[model samples]
Target: DVKRGKWEAPELLKEAKSFINKHKDSNTKIGKLRYMAVEDKASGTGLIQSISKQTTLPIRAIQRSTDKLSRTMDVILYVEERRVWLPANAPWLLNYIEEIEGLTADWTHDHDDQWDPTIDAINDSLAKKPTVFD
Candidate 1:
């Protein structure tokens, strides 16, 4: 051989490129479980507790599931302005969460204007004071 022709310049010198923009083919089991955790209109902060109660799973196990889901969706749920925010990209998903899960969009739990439980207490007191219907 004139120059030891074992490799070519293009093959040996070129560096391979990686494209990571594309996500996985489908959602993982843990991801789906995490979505369902919030599907019951559970509180954003109390997601772990709610999921634990609903699924009867230990906190550690639920935490593992939550970890998996957080990787996919950062803002799982939120509350703000005395309202909750929900995760819904498709009409079907929104309806499913509403009708099947009996949950509404309550994603504002982590907003600057946090929901105040005291307001609900005040409303409750007012409600019990004396209603014209009563």
Candidate 2:
């Protein structure tokens, strides 16, 4: 089954990357991917809050690490969503997102959407715009 479904993984990753690249300044894409990477972990959920609780790494440090990696890498891993996105130009970021997603998926199967305060703020800000992309 793993071999037969092998193509599915790449396809999913391609789709996820396309989705992320298509929407410039998409808060959902940014938040979801970052959240998944940081929150989805084995010993601890890779979530920002979880990371903050379990380690001395400050939330800002986690955020900065993710941001710096995204800026320098080709792919960004959204582990919670079990997908990876290619950052249009930066191929390095693609693997980063994939790593995060892999770590997140390994920890659990329940991909339920959790309440995100950041998403709410982003949504509110987006609502004021003529369009989310614009």
Candidate 3:
């Protein structure tokens, strides 16, 4: 919780690893993203609170940019919603990051040249703003 925004992404990743090492147990993973059911969609109070408390990230920051920060770190315990879920068997959403590029999805396709963002179809889908559902 000390050096969140202030620290570099790699440092934050280390923090995430430390957090995950402490939290994850049998039948439960800490770093992986999960679908969460919330009480309300408009305010997003419960969901935000849960994520904030668990991730040690401020709600405002999470609200502003969720994926960017999350992709780098490994031990983020925050909960996203079903809205973020891609189509059935979304091979693109395999992972949240890459070493060469900035924050980007981990595509499952073997033929893909990840460096070519133009061919990455996942970006098109992600370009659409996330819809809040109840």
Candidate 4:
């Protein structure tokens, strides 16, 4: 896990590599058509470059315009309507659900990082057209 302190580029790169390797099969399945989006600022720039050079995973740099709450709220309807689905018996299932439940509009929590990409993916899907991924 990434600690809440200063991080060097090398450290971040190593962590990214570990994460990518850990999910190698899924990454391969995701393929070149789908991108792994990263914020287009600060360390994210380096991360995109590093991941692109070191792994086969495609990377898309995203420039976030809206605040966290607004971004998350955009997908709230999907969640409420039970359109969002989680893995049936994943090990982290309970923790993931707890994080979703813990989210507040007031930005009073620490799970935003974990949930941001999920919301982004859902919004991106809904924006284009409703689709399911295995």
Candidate 5:
């Protein structure tokens, strides 16, 4: 789609606003969104800033410092220990599982792109240290 055309800031803002509104109307609570911080050599700060202003949502622009393979490897123990859970019957479940299953240590593999944020979510939201009840 990049070759066809890419979304401009205004379009991105509109889509973000609509999506947030839908979640709000449905009583869904979304936590802070983590936007991968663009590197100094890249050109996306303006877009992220614009969307932040338009949505007024808690958006954390974070730079991923660790290597993808390392981050991917860290979650394995959590999965083996049953700390990661997926919603049953979710429409995206199959594709998500497929992507997870397709992940490999090979740097050339394409599945990492689909799994980066997912691993982030697992690390940030789900895979916490055990409590007594847990």
Candidate 6:
């Protein structure tokens, strides 16, 4: 899949390093607190909702966190080749290959019938629309 935003490798690396440094000490009270569990409760609902609405920080922070976790890898889905390729350097790829293969198989089974086109139906549909891509 085409990523909508640009990838900044340096910034991502810096953010990853910072995250590691900040979280390296697991004994801290703040680190021990499960933010996700807390955020799921009724009391935290309003706080979570308000935070989500008020700032772009959450999405940016998540993207940064994902970038950090992945380290050197880039996530890519090649549409033309109908293949999902992951770098050999990325060890996590091994863990997900089976899942990715299953997804491709499922997608092909679901969409197989849609590939055949009828000329009469195509022409009729074309006549109704000024431009198909639009």
lDDT of each: 0.28, 0.34, 0.35, 0.72, 0.59, 0.32
lDDT of 6 by residue, 8-125 (tens): 5444334434444444446374343122211233433444454445433342211122321132122221222434234565554554444333434224432221111111123223
- How much is the lDDT of residue 50 in candidate 5? 65
| lDDT of model 5, residue 125 | 63
Candidates arranged by lDDT, highest first: 4, 5, 3, 2, 6, 1
TM agreement with the true structure for every prediction: 0.16, 0.20, 0.20, 0.75, 0.69, 0.24
Model 5: residues with Cα > 4 Å off, grouped in runs: 1-10, 25-44, 127-134
What digit string (tens of lDDT, one per residue) describes model 5 on residues 72-111?
Answer: 7788787878787777766777877887788766776565
Candidate 5: lDDT over CA atoms? Answer: 0.59
Candidate with maximal lDDT: 4
Q: For residues 1-134, what per-residue lDDT tens digits would candidate 2 score against the true structure?
A: 00111224345344434443444245564453232222232322323343345433233311222432332232222323434223465544454435434444234523212212222223333323575775
For candidate 4, report its TM-score. 0.75
> Model 3, range 1-134, lDDT digits (tens) per residue?
11122234455445544554454442242243222222233344544454555654333312223333343232222112222333344454443323223423564434322322221223323433576851
- Which scores better on lDDT, 2 or 5? 5
Ranking by TM-score: 4, 5, 6, 2, 3, 1
Cα lDDT tens digits for candidate 4, 15-134: 767765666556453342345677778998988888898777777888889888787777788888988777676677777778778887687877666687777778777644654852
Candidate 2 matches the true fold with a TM-score of: 0.20
Query: Of 1 and 6, which scores higher on TM-score?
Result: 6
lDDT assessment of candidate 2? 0.34
Specify the highest-TM-score model's number.
Answer: 4
Report lDDT (Cα) of residue 115, candidate 6: 17
The superposed Cα distance between candidate 6 and the true structure at residue 11, in angstroms, equals 26
> Model 4 off-target regions past 4 Å?
1-7, 26-34, 129-134
